[model samples]
Target: MKEAENRACEVMLHAGLLPQLATMETIAAAAGPVLEPFVQYLLRHISTPRGVDGVSPFELNAALANALIEGEEALTGLVSLAVSIVPLAPAAATTNSSSLTAATSGGVCSVSSLTRVRLTLHPAYPLNLIATDSFLNLHTMLWTLSLQLQWVAQSLIAARVCLWKESQSQKRSGTDNNTTFSTTTAPSTRAVQQEMLHLVHAVRQHMLTHVENTSVRMRRGIATCGSLREMQKQCGEYEEELRHGCLLHDTSSSQLGSRKWHNHNDGPAASASGSPELHSSLLEVLESSLRHCILLGHARQAKILINKAKQAQLEAEDAEQEALALDSLEFAKQKFSQITCAVAATEREFEGHRVAFMERVSVYGSEAGAHSDAARALLAAVDIQGRWQPQKGT
Candidate 1:
């Protein structure tokens, strides 16, 4: 009886239960009143000369101990057998002081040495196996879904690029098609821009899912079930995981945008971006900030972009409007010939405003150094998060 109770206590202790809670004295005291009778009956049966192919108590106990201590696979099978027999062993189940819950006809058996060991050996392993199996079965379907979504994002980007280029080309061609386009073209263009914006938003949103999942798993991996030292070790690994992933992500994204710019806009094809030095420096700073944000797990310079861009856009709009008003006035100056001096001064002022407006647009467009920097920052955020995958097994 003491041996059986001791074995049960050991199983509980290994399963992360407090040792004091499953102490030998407590278990023995708890099982004494009811367990003594079952033990006596079993002993009497085994001792009988005509015992049904009986095994000796010493032999049986030795075999059981050996199996429980060394034969993990066999022990697990025994535990399953015990759980299965719980319905027929109501009294035996009730007398046991262990904590494993196995449902049975009479009630529930709460003694499972096997389950405890399996859980102790590798808690994450079982969970990983289950998740991986599920993922495998559905991976093909998920890939199809991902491809469709990627197609949408790519299509929207391509369309926006095409339309923007076409608009610039038309302006360069001295086309006066604005009058013909007044009916539906403006609305259609707006719709396309809106769709493109929606697609960008969707892509960004989907990227967040991967980041969130990675965060959750990292937290879980760092969670401690043992002592403080173990916890610290787990936490250190988690931090390393975060730092490495962030740095790699930031660097990779920066390089991706740099390569794209080199291929499309930077190579001698009009040198869209002005001030190469400023552009390169800005990109470096932005990329650094993005890396900092990823490692620290928070946005660092997102506000800087917001504040700067807002101011720049406002100034650009005001300048653009002033220039347009001056142009209109200059066009209608024949009737007001007396205001020729005013018109000339206004034209000079408009030219100044035009330069300022161009500077701002160039800054915002692929032509300005700031554009390259901002593009690197934003794309780094998007691209890094996009390619991120939170997998198990480190």
Candidate 2:
């Protein structure tokens, strides 16, 4: 039963059914009853390596960084099949009528246990499904992260290609036929610029798609928690507030600047209180606000990306650990097979042995034969080897 529960837990974690423990307290709260000693171990490991001040930006970033790193490792461990504990079915009372049914069920159970754990990449929730809001939010964050990575990769590729082309162009221009193709440079520059623009445009489209998908996933997560509606209300209110503030600031700046421009025609524009000066101030304020908005958007997006990368890293680590475990299991099986073969060989060599020897040979071929074979082989080689020669002389 314990083994079965552990297998179920592993399956849940790998399937992402188990929510990530974001805090040590949360981890304890969720898993303490089920895994007391393990939870305690986790708590000890999770204790603050260094104190962090919540109000300090540096400390907050550092804490988040550490959480993400550890979270990634944990996620990876979960994903790999190495974490699975295949639960054995209990033996049933056998009767002639049930025998065939039991046999079939046993086969089915074996097949099921052998099935690999698969990850289901869910789509973002529908815009209407408030039920999945949290999942949608998480999905959105991952999508944003993927987009950022893709954008960076594309930018690097584009830059390298552009540089290579420029170098080639310079080399060609320096050659004998240079003047003949000089006119091509203008068109080439235009083409290169267009390509770069296209790449940027494509990246933006990809990001938009990712956002939509993530939004769906977040909605699903929210729905699972029965908080989708609440999340939707909060998000709507937040968006409304952001839009209202932005519009109001924009309007105020435009109004103030226009008035100052009109007033400047009548007075000396250069004076501190004049329209020209006030206009400059107004423009600065507008620009500053816009910059602030942009920064906020960027920060939000960056946070999402970080979260997504952390998830991906976790999945990767799980895969690695699972592979290692499978390798270990295979290694053990091979060692067992080698021992079995050796035991069989030794038994064949002593086919005419007495009851004790026959028992030893039987043990070497039994389910737990590896150790028995080693023991028997050691004893026979050491104590019984010379004595057996007398039988041959007789």
Per-residue lDDT tens digits for candidate 1, residues 169-198, read: 656765334211223453454353443345
- After superposition, which runs of candidate 2 have C-alpha atoms over 4 Å from their true positions? 1-73, 77-173, 177-183, 186-202, 205-224, 227-394
Q: lDDT of all predictions, in order shown?
A: 0.31, 0.31
Q: Cα deviation of 164 in candidate 1 (Å)? A: 1.5
Where is model 1 more than 4 Å wrong at Cα? 1-128, 138-142, 176-187, 203-207, 214-394
Top TM-score hit:
1
Clashing pairs in 1: 272-367, 273-367
Worst 10 residues of 2 by lDDT: 110-119
How does residue 63 of candidate 2 score in lDDT?
A: 40
